[model samples]
Target: MRTEGDTWDIVSSVGMTALFVAAIRAAETKQPDALVHDEFAALFVAAAGDPDTNRLIDDPELWADSPLGLGFMGLRSKFFDDHFRAATEAGVRQAVILAAGLDARAYRLDWPQGMVVYEIDQPKVLEFKGQVLADAHATPTADRREVAVDLRDNWPAALIEEGFDPARPTVWSAEGLLPYLPGAAQDALFARIDQLSAPGSSLATDTFGSDVDFQQLADFQTEQMRDTSFGKIDIADLLYTDDRSDPAEWLTKQGWTTKAAPPEELAARYDRPLTEVLEPYAQMFNGMKYLTAVKPS
Candidate 1:
């Protein structure tokens, strides 16, 4: 369960989810046909040094039963990576990654000259990432800065204080974040992004479908991870799965030009069709889509 002012570190509660995602990315990176290669992901896992998590990533039998395994995460990573690439091609030099948990984009992506990437997340999470990368001696391709603050707080002020320029066209990403926020907070978050975005700013995110039943989704995920170490902390308890406005639709209503791509299309586009893997989970992801919205100049 979650509270109004809850806080978590790298391997507990919400923070553990970040480690889980990184583990998946690490597994994908080792694959011969990996869609996205995040070298630092494995490093993050190693730094945490959690035996169960290590086993989850290294043990083939346990990983095979995990939901949204390598294929889905690989395809998903590529989609977002392409979004950033397109943003750079379009001359957007500034970027912000919201809830940037264990994400290695700044260090991995070949950012343009003078590109600045701001990563926002909890203080401890950012601290952990900074220390891990520092120890690994990894250098970022872009001028990366960490805005250590909770999203539920006044993060806008913190971002601005960290030299974020609201006048410049920026590329923003809120990947795997919305589900953790309450419905009202989700709307507030978008409104803040809209307020801060300049003309020509673009945003990309992965949002749940309106048709998803939280109860069923939770049950399925719980069952799938029951035999693994991940099952101990029920993800359903961390998520606020109440009904909420569709992100693309909400952005459209806010006057942004939005484009949505279904997972099947993205999976096929990347040559990793998910039909068979998604069959059992079809209802849970019925209308889920990857959304990209642009604010017109």
Candidate 2:
């Protein structure tokens, strides 16, 4: 279990999750009908220096047991890609990516001129990402700033110190982040985001459902992880299965207009319906709703 002061780079624990997602994105990018293309994803995975993780990136059969999980990662990536793009197009010039892992959005996405992308995460994680991207000679599409701090700390203060313009309309995203935080911490995160948001600011997040059997799902995830090349590192250990409030409902109560959609709806919209093997996993995965909300102007 990760403690309050526990720190990780891009190759272990919570950091590994980032590399895992990047591997999946790398795989999805090679697909003919890819929903999103993250060109730098594979580079980050290769730089992780873990043989098993690198094997997972190179071998298709390594993820064969979790087809739905793979597909959902692709879908989730595209969903957030669109969400950030929409926010930028809507004139929100400042964007914050909470718990920004190895996400290369600041480097890969086309940002509006003069836009600023603030990446908030642990210092080491940000350092590793910067080094790898720098080694690859990659440059950000926006004026990118790295706010190196843990979520449980005074991150808003750190963000502000890094020149974050909270008074200006900002777009904030907490992708693949909620489950790692305890119930109380999740609530506190949104409260902090709400406190910083200006009128016309928006927030997007993906969270697990309150109704799902988390124990059963965690067990299944453990089994699947063990069966793959990346099996030695149990992804389940990084998750905090404590009961958390519904994000969409909570956002609405906070006076924001919100919309929530399951992976099935998003899959259908993208014309990539789930297969039979993917059905049960889809049900479990669908429990995670992709939510987007706008604060009243």
Each prediction's TM-score versus the true structure: 0.95, 0.94
lDDT tens digits, residue span 144-164, model 1: 999999888899999999999
Compute the lDDT of residue 158 as modeled in candidate 2.
Answer: 94
Residue 222 shift from truth in candidate 2, angstroms: 3.4
State the lDDT at 50 in candidate 1: 78
Please report how far candidate 2 places residue 260 from its true position, in Å.
0.3
Residue pairs in collision within model 1: none
